[model samples]
Target: MPSCQPLNRMKKVLTAQAEAEKIRRIGEAEAGSIEAIGKAEAEKMRLKAEAYQHYGEAAKTALVLEALPKIAGKVAAPLAQTSEIVILSRDGSRVTGEVNRLLAELPVSVNALTGVDLMKIPFLQKMTNPQA
Candidate 1:
C-alpha cells in the first residue's frame, strides 16, 4: 500500500502539470490572435485616411478646372470691347499710336488685338495715304 500511495501522488502531480501547460498555451494563442486583429485594424485605418486625403486633392483640382473658363471669359470681355473702337487719324502711324494709347489706359493687360481686320476697313486706305 505504501508503494501504491507514492505512485498515485506522482500521477496526480503529472496530470496537474499537463493541465497547466495546456492553459498557458491557450492563453498565449488568444493573446497572439488579439494582437494580430489590432494590427489589421490599424492598417485599415491608415489606408482609409490616405484615400480621403487624395480624394480631397482631386476635388480641389476638379473645382479649379471647372472655374477656369468662366474666369478667362470675364477677363477677356472688356479687352474684346476695346478693340472695336475706330481711330480716325489722317496718318496711319498716328492712328496706331492712338490705338496703343487707348489700350494702355484700360484696367486689364492687352497684349494682342482680335475680332477685326484693319486692312478690310475702307477708312484705313485714306489713313495710310495722307496725300490722297
Candidate 2:
C-alpha cells in the first residue's frame, strides 16, 4: 500500500505539469493572434491614409478645371470691348506721320496693349479695313 501511495502521488504531479504546459501553450497562441490583429489594423489604416491623399489631389484638380474658363473670360473681358477708329489717307508718308502722332498722344504703353488695341487705332486704317 505504501508503494502504491507514492505511485499515485507521482501520477498527480505529472498530471499537474501536463495541465500547466497546456495552459502555457494556449496563452502563447492567444498572444500571437493579438499581434496579427494589430498588424492587420495598422495596414488598414495606412491604406486609408493613402486613399484620402489621392482623393484630395483629384478634388483640387477638378476645382481648377472647373474654374479655368471663368478665369480666362475675366482676363479677356477688358480687351474685347474696345472699338477701333479708322482714318483714310492717300499717301503712305502721311499715314506714317499720323500714326506717329497718335502714338505720341496715347496715355498707355503701346507695348502692353493687345492686338485688339492695335486694330482700334484710327490712323492705322489698313489694320481695321477688311477690304484691304
Instruction: List the lowest-lDDT window of 10 residues for candidate 1.
Output: 107-116
User: How does candidate 2 score on lDDT?
Assistant: 0.67
TM-score of each: 0.41, 0.41
Question: On residues 1-96, what C-alpha lDDT tens digit does candidate 2 reach at each position?
Answer: 257888899999999999999999999999999999999999999998887577754464455445646866897799688786576778889988
Cα deviation at 40, candidate 2, in Å, is 0.4
Question: Whole-model Cα lDDT per candidate?
Answer: 0.66, 0.67
* Tens-place lDDT digits, model 1, residues 8-122: 9999999999999999999999999999999999999999887757765446445544564686799887888684765577779987787788754431222122322333334
The segments of candidate 2 whose C-alpha lies over 4 angstroms from its true place after superposition are 57-132
